[model samples]
Target: MSSKRVVFDFDIAFTNGGGIQGQDFRLDIDGDTITDKELADYIVNDMQLLMVRKVDIINKHYITEAHKRKPVNLKADEKLVDLSHTIFDGLVTYKGLPAPIICDYLSREQSKVNYEEGTEFQIGKITMVTNTGTYIDCPFHRFEHGKDLSEVALEQFADLDAVTINAKDAIEIGKEYFVGKELRNKAVLVFTNWAKHWNTELYFENHPYLTGEAAQYLKECQVKLVGIDSHNIDDTRGKSRPVHTTLLGAEILITEHLCNLDKLPENGYKFNAVPPKFKGAGTFPVRAYASLG
Candidate 1:
């Protein structure tokens, strides 16, 4: 489906307060035509304004321009690409960390007793450390006084504008790799092609990592999150972890052990990586994905 947009003027009245109005405001729409009620609902949901009592649309027109956001359906051009490593029993992410243990809490045969005849269901249970697979490290992972997973707002992990940096053959990625790039308020993912050696012994040796200068540069740029398709984001040969220290100290989130990064373009898409809400936990696994159209 081709991208379509609506241009119109709107007068909105609040449920208990003043009113708001707009002229020539543009918005993405699903189809070529839309009812005024549906358009009002779209504006309310997208803008996230207060309660609206009623809306009046005027001078409405449709255009065939590119979508700034989204209002597409399954038959449209929007696509969702997975950018995480699948975790199963005995799968190692880090060198020293243990693998996840997956089992069934209630088997189908055992669940049959809880329900009527010919009806059954199964419940699964998993036991593993928070950082077992492709995981995110919040500020609390390094600083005890920083925000935990639950304290981090949901907006930080939803519909975030993102870009990818291709560093396929480099070992020590420096600030030069990230210089002159749009790095502010976006999830900058570094594609290292190191995922080719995933699940192999070579994956744990001499993996790609960001240098101290690069970490400091990203921090200075005020990037929202940093991700790498490698085993570790910091050099593991020594005792010090300067990359994690610098970035996490500034409250910049980190995501390591990412996979399928090559499927994403350098820009023009959104990134979402959300973990289960956990209190007092710093790092946890996430099913990260990229959205594009």
Candidate 2:
């Protein structure tokens, strides 16, 4: 009998639009030790789950180190690529509401003076809610008993082993969809095809969502994190948020309003969606991104 072996792929592809779809993993065991026929029988008989393990190794490796070394260089005279955008303005506010106001200014103060003879200075403050744009809802957003945004450990938000589930057209995501899958101790990202309605009213109604049973199953499995590229993780029309309640109640962080998830591989790139460490705050906008290293 030959020894058993497993093959892991790190360069998984995350699509460019919204839905999450990519290679999560492909397990390979020695044919002599386990026998191809025996392995197939085990899967048919529901015993293969015991033979695979998906480990989180983000802390032990640099996520963007590969990109840093081999930067994306354009022509020396080429125009730069504009990567930043303000998606949330007066047009579309949180919960389809109004935006915040800005006030206060220090016009006369100056720190250093490359002072022109007729110079003026101004300082100001802006008052906006945390859910101004694409944001993350930590466990504290739902439960007072859970850890607040500041109290959440950094490891929970950054350098996470990410898995993207393709649920774009799925009306309901249930436990059956994830049963027997290695979901424990990893970031479980859901890519619903709802982002297509980003600026339209359709994005707010009848959107796809994870079932309450699925949330409970994830919590029981101890998923490290949960994210969805949708307006809200819960059904907007429903009063009870069983999905959010179950996952957050178990102290799992939730990230909402993610874009470019389609660009991520199902199980390869390192996911990092970090919010500010603000005390007493449960939710905040984040520069959520993935590192394909």
Q: Which one wins on TM-score?
A: 1
Each candidate structure's TM-score, on Cα atoms with residue i matched to residue i, is 0.74, 0.65
In terms of lDDT, model 1 sits at: 0.90
What's the lDDT for candidate 2? Answer: 0.66
How do the residues 220-264 of candidate 1 rate in per-residue lDDT, one tens digit apiece? 999999999998999999999999999989988999999889999
* Per-candidate clashes, comma-separated: 0, 12
**Cα RMSD (angstroms) for every candidate in the order listed:** 9.0, 18.0
Which regions of candidate 2 fall more than 4 Å away from where they truly are? Answer: 1-85, 91-93, 100-124
- Residue 106 local lDDT, model 1: 99
Local distance difference test scores for all models: 0.90, 0.66
